[model samples]
Target: MAVVKVDKKGRLVIPQEIRERLRIDETTPLIFEVDDGNTIRIRIIQRDDQAYTSDPLWKAIHNPVFIGKKVSKKELDEIENDQWSN
Candidate 1:
């Protein structure tokens, strides 16, 4: 557990220890929402780093709309190896 101070601009630095434990870096995307009137929730959106073919691919693969989806190995391979039509 760590204490973070929110700066004037509503930005706070996540401590190094927590960041390392969460495997969070500059590339990680975060989601924030209000659980109730006084409580807020933050989550580090999980992603498939291993299945990422490139940076763009990583962004596309981890889209929120695709969460809880099960992609078969064959389908993923086909997508990864497929070249852009344009």
Candidate 2:
């Protein structure tokens, strides 16, 4: 088990091993919540927007929104290399 100390400024530095395991870094976005006891729980936002750029379904729905119209099925097929129907 790992133990951490909160500094005078109320900041706790997570251990390096834990950070690496959870893929947390300086720029990582997080969501903080509290339980009934008011202890805070922190979660890493793994996807945020990076996945939207490369994830096929997300691209299919969002790509054309940038140009102000729904894309043609043909264009979508081309983007998916004709495998979108499958």
Instruction: State TM-scores per candidate.
Output: 0.51, 0.49
Model 1, residue 67: C-alpha shift (Å): 31
Error of 2 at 78 (Å): 47
lDDT of 2 by residue, 1-86 (tens): 58898999998888999999888889786767887685778867666567545778767776664667789988987979866666
**Residue 51 of model 2, lDDT score:** 51
Clash pairs detected, candidate 1:
none
lDDT of 1 by residue, 1-86 (tens): 77788999999999998889999999887778999997778877766543334567666775645547899999878877785432
Q: How accurate is candidate 2 locally (lDDT)?
A: 0.77
Give the Å error, residue 53, model 2.
13
